[model samples]
Target chain A: MSDDIGQKKGLTRRGFLKSAGGVAAVAGMAAGGVAVGARDGLAAAGSMPKKWDQGYDVVVIGTGFAGLAAAIEAKNAGASVVVIDKMPVHGGNSIINGGDFCAPGTRLQKAAGVQDSPDLMYKDMMKAGLYLNNPELARILADNAGGALEWCEDYVGAKFTRLNFHGGHSVKRANQTVNASGSELVNKMLAKAKGLGVEVKTRTKMERMIANKDGRVVGVEVKTGYRYPDEKTGKTAYIKAGKAVILTSGGFSNDITLRQIQDPRLTEKFGSTNQPGATGEALLAACMAGAMDVQMDWIQLGPWTSPDEKGFGHVPLFCERLVGYGPMIDPATGKRFFKETGNRKERADAIILIGHPVIIMGDSYAVPKQVFPRALEKGLENGAIKKFDSLEALAKNYNIPLEAFQKEISRWNSFVEKKKDDDFGCMIFPEARPTVTPPFYAARLWPKVHHTMGGLVIDKNAQVFGFNLKPLKGLYAAGEVTGGIHGAVRLGGVAMADCIVFGRIAGKNAAKETAWG
Target chain B: MTRKHGNIRFSPGWLFAAALAFGVLLVYIGTPYAAPKQVASAKAGDCAACHGQEKVFSPSHPDTKAMSYKDCLGCHAKGGPQMLQGKLPGSHLHQLRGVTCEKCHGKVAKPEAVEEKLCRTCHNAEKLVEKTAKVKPENPHTSPHYGTSLDCTLCHRQHAKSENYCNQCHKFNFVVP
Candidate 1:
C-alpha cells in the first residue's frame, strides 16, 4: 500500500536514494514517502540476520501479568527464557490496575459461598460479548481460569483475600488481590520468575520479528536501553529465539492512530485507561510476519470513568461499586437512563449516545457499605465524587432540574423499596435500601477506552495463527496481544485471568517447539 | 561508479541496504540525540559553562555569572512571580546548592544517570511525603497506588524539563521539578 503511494508521489525508495546523496539523503527519503505504512517504515520480517547478539530459548515481550507468567512457565519447563520491556519500570498497566481477577469455582468463591462454574462464566462472557467470541478459545479460558488463579495464589504466593462482583457476571466471581492492585500478583510473579532463573530485562524493546525463508519466526531485532515513547533511546541488537518468541506486549487502548484504524470513534478525543506503553506496534509487527488478527474493531470503553480525573481514576471504584445500589441519572433530563448494572459496552454506549457525561449516585448508606473507604476518600478529595446533604443539594450542585430530579429520585426509591427496577431494569442488589439517608454521594461518568478486544488470532495452545490457517511456527502469543477470547467485549476482571491462563500455555508450548537454531 | 566510505562497499544493493539499515539504526539510537552538556568547572555562576552559547534567561534578567543559591533568591525566590523551583532543571538547583556532577554520579569520564538512592541520601522519601501531605488536589510525593515507592527520577529529571509522570493515567497536575 505504501509502495503505491511512494510510486504516485515520485519518491520511491530507490529513486529517492538516486536523487539524493550520502547519509543525509536518508533523512530526505524518510521525509519524502519511502515509508508510509508502519511496517514499511521499519525493517521487514524477511530481514534475516546472519549472526545474533543474544540468544534465548523463549523470548517474552512485555513484563506485565502475562509476560512474567510466560517467562516463569517457560523457565520451569526447562527453557532458557528472557522477558523484556521497553519501560524503565517492570510492571506495565498491571501494576496500577485495580486487582480484580475473575475465575469460576475458586477458593475465594468457595469461601464466599458464591456458586459459580466454568459453564456459567463462559455463558456470561458469550452473552456480554454478543456471541462473537470464538467458542473454543473462550471455552479454554473459562475452563482454565480457576487453575490459573490457583497457580497465582499457591505458586506465586499472591493473596486473593476477597471475592467481588462485576457487571455481566452470574455471581461474585472476581477475586480481589490482597493489596487491591494487580501489583500484588504481578510483583509476586516477577519475583517467582527471577527466582526461577528467568532474566527480566527492562528498557529492552522489540524492533521487529525476523522470519527465515521458510516463513517461520526465528528471532527478533531489539534495542536495549529503550525508553518509553522514545523510538531512538535503545541500542540495536538481534536476539535469536531458538525455541519461540511469545508476544505479550499488550493492547493499543492508548494508541489513538492504531485504535482509530479499527474503531473510528476511538479518536484522540477518547481518553484511555491504559498506560501509554499499551500501543499496537508489536501486534502489528506480528501481523507483518503473517499473523492473522481477529475482531480488531471490538474496543471496549469503561463507562464508569470520570472525565474530571486522568487515566483510570478513583471514580470507577465509586461508580462500579454503587451501580446496583443506586441509579445512573442523565443530568439534562434528571431521569434514570440505562440499566446501571449493564455490561461495560452497553453502559459506555448508552452514555456516549447521550453525548454528555451522566451521573451515578448513592446515599450515605450505600456509599460507606458498597464503596471502598480509601477510594471514597480519594474520590472526594479529587472532587470527582461529591457529597450532598440532601437530594435538593445534589440537584442544585449538578444543575439538575429540581422537580424532575425529585420525581425521578422518588420513583427510584419506590423501585428500591419494592426491590425491583421497573424504569431501567437495573438490578437492585438484595441488600440495597432506599436512598432516603442524608449526605448523598455522586460522580460524573464519561467513557474511557479501556481494552482492545481484537488482536492476533491464537489457538487453544496459544500458538499464533497465520493467514494460511496454520500456526505461525516459532511464534506464540497470550494476554491482550491475542484476540477472540473475549469476542466483542471483555468482561471486567477477565483480563488478568486471560493473561495468566494463556501466558502459561503459550510458554509451555513455545518451550516445546523444535529449536530452529 | 559507487561512492565508497571507510570499510563499507557502496553499491546500489549495498546503498539500499545501508539506507534501510541506517533507518533502523536511527530508530535504535533515537533521533535528535543530544549529548549531555559537560560543564568545565563546578562553579555555580558559570552560565556559559554547561549551557554553552544557549541563552537561557531573558535579556532583561540581571547578570548571574557570580551569583550563589542565596543570591538567586533575590528575585526568583519562593512564592515570587517567576519562581525557578519547578521551572529550571533539577541540575541547576543541585549546582546552585554545590552538589556538582561528582556528588551524585561520582568522578567518571562519562557521568551516567544516578540511582534513586543518590536522591534519597538528602531527600528522604518519607520526610518529603510528610512535608507535602497537605498539598491540594492530591499529594505529589506519595500516592495510594505506589505510595512513595515511585522513583524520584520518574518526575525530577536533572537535565530535562521535569514532568508529572502520574499524569500518564491521572490528572494530578503536579508541577514536578
Candidate 2:
C-alpha cells in the first residue's frame, strides 16, 4: 500500500511540474535571491511538495486577533479550517496589546455622552493617515467596526467596560477591556475558535504559499513542530487548502533588516514595541507568490514609550492617559515644545527631532484620575515613572531650568483653566484641573518603533491583489498583513477594530470560494 | 581429542559477532563519558554505567552508589544552599526517584525528543496550576496568554538546564526548576 501511494505521489508531482513549467520558470528567476540572501524567500516559487501532509477547506496563517477571528468565522461558515502560528503560543502581538477597541456609536460612547459616528471615525483615521488611506477600505473598516466590536463583546463573550480616548480621535470612542489587556479579547476569541472545531496549531510556521499553475494559491508549505526563531528545526510539510488561504500574519515591526530596507532611519538604534517573532518572512513568502505590497515604508514610532523600560512598557499607559490632563515639557529648555495631545506621529517626530527624551507630567489629581492604577504602580516600581512632592523637585530631578519650568507650568495651567491652548492648540478636557496640586507624577518619553502601516495590498473584500492589480485567486489577507487600510498612520485603538472588521470579511469570503480539487 | 578440536572451529557468523563485540568494547573504552546508555535496571548512583571512570563527584564526597532520593535529601534539604532542585539536572532527580530512562523514553534503541504528553502522564497540568497558585507575582504553571497549555519541557528541561520562558517578555524572575 505504501509503495503504491508513493508511486502515485511521484506521478502526480511529475504531472504538476509539467503543467506548471512556464510559471515555474518565471518564479525560479524571481526566487533566485533565496539561495544567497540571508533573509529571503523560504522556498523556490512553484515548488509544490510531492504530497500534501494535511488538508483543510481554509487555511489561516497567524493566530493573532485577525487570524483567530478569521478561523472562527471560517469554521462557523461550515468550512473545515486550520490556523497556524510560528510561535509556541497563540495570539501573536494581539495578546500583549493594550486592550482598546475604537468603534464609533457604541454603548460605551452613548453612556459616556460622547457623540461619535463612523463618519467622524473615518475622518479621524484619514486625517491622521494624511489622506493617503484607500477610501473604500477605510470606509469598510469604519462601517463594520461597530458590528465587529459588538461581535467581540456579545458573541465572543469579551468585555469592554470603560470608554477611553486616543489623541487622534475627536472624542472619546475607545472601549477598553476590563482587564486593560488584549489577552481578554484574544483569549476569548481563541476559546471561541477552538469551541467551533477550528484546528489551531501553534509552532507550525508557514514556509511558502503554494500556488497552482494558474496562480491560484492552493495550499501552504509549512514546518511542523517548529521551534520559533530556529530555522533548522521542524519537518517540512504541506497543508492543502481546498478553498483558500488567508494570510493574517502581522507586520514586520521587529524585523530590523526588512524595516531598514524600507525605512533606512529605522535602524537598530530604535527598539520596537513588538514580540520577537514579529518578522516579515511570511509576508515576503506571500509576495513571492505574487501578492503586491503598498506603502512599505510608512512605519510608525510610538511617542510615549520610555527608554528606561522595555518593549511597550508601562510608560505608554501613563503617558497616553495623562495627555489631555497634563503638560509635556522639554527637559532641556523646561518648556512645552509640541501640543501635549498631538497624534502619535506628530509627537514621535517632535521628540525624534529634539535628539533627546522629553517629559510628560501630570499632577496628583490628574495622575490618580487619568492613569490606570496598575500602570501607575508598575511604572513607579520600575523607575520609569517618577513621583515628586513639588514642581521644583520634579524640575530638579530632570535637570530642567526651574524658573522656565515654573513659568511653563503656569502657562499650561492657564490653558487648562480656559480649556484652550493658544501656543500649540493642545486639547484640554473639561475635567482637567490646574497643575497646582502637589505630588506630581512624571515619565520620560522616547520613541520606539511600534507599528508598520504597510503590507500586502488588499481590496475591500480583503482579497489580496497581485502585482497586476487583480485579486489573487484563493488568497485573502487582513489585519497588519494587509496594507492600505490605515494608509500612513494607524490610530491608537483602530488596530483591534481593523483586524476584527476585515478578518471576519476575509474568513467568510475565503470559505465561500469553490474548491479547486 | 581430534573430533573435539574440529568441533571448536569458529563459524563465519561467530567470527562476525566477535569482531562486532570487540569494536563496541574499543569504543566504550576510548570514550568513557559518552552519551548515556539505556540501562533500565541500573541504580541512580551507578554513574559508572554511563560515565565510566569519570569523576562525577568530589573526592571527599560520600559514596552514593546505595543512596536513594530520600537519602540525598538528608544533606541537600529543601530551601538550603545545596538544594538539588535547581543545581542538578532534572533527570538526575527523576533517576534518583527510581524512574529509569525507559520509563519516559520507552524501550527504544534510539530515544528521540518526547512530547509533553509523556510528561502529562505523570504530572497533571491542572493540579500543577493549583499547587503553584500562590507563587508570588504570578502563577508559573498557568497564564492568561497560554493558560496551562505550555509545553512542560519549555521550563523544566530534563537533560539540560531549565529556563524561565516567561522572562523573554516579562520580568517575572521565576526561579524555574
Clash totals, every prediction: 3, 0
TM-score (C-alpha, index-matched) for candidate 2: 0.82
Candidate 1: how many backbone clashes? 3
- Fnat: each model in turn: 0.36, 0.12
Candidate 1 residues lying further than 4 Å off, grouped into runs, are: A1-44, A363-369, A388-403, A417-419, A429-440, B1-37, B48-84, B105-151
lDDT of candidate 2 over A1-517, digit per residue (tens): 3343334443433343333342234335534644344233322345566899999999999999999999988999999999999998889899988799999999999997889999999999999899999999999999989999999999999999999877778999899998878999999998899988999999999977888767789999887888777664566689999999999999999999999999987878788888888999999888888889999999999998998888888899899888889999999999999988887888999998888899999998999998989899988887889999999999999999999999999999999999999899988988999998889999999889988999999987899998767898999999998888888999989999999999999999999999999
Return the top candidate by DockQ.
1
What's the true lDDT of residue A387 in model 2? 95
Interface RMSD of each: 9.7, 15.3
TM-score of chain A of each: 0.88, 0.86
lDDT of 1 at A261: 86
Report the lDDT of model 1 for residue A229. Answer: 72
Candidate 2 lDDT score at position B135: 77
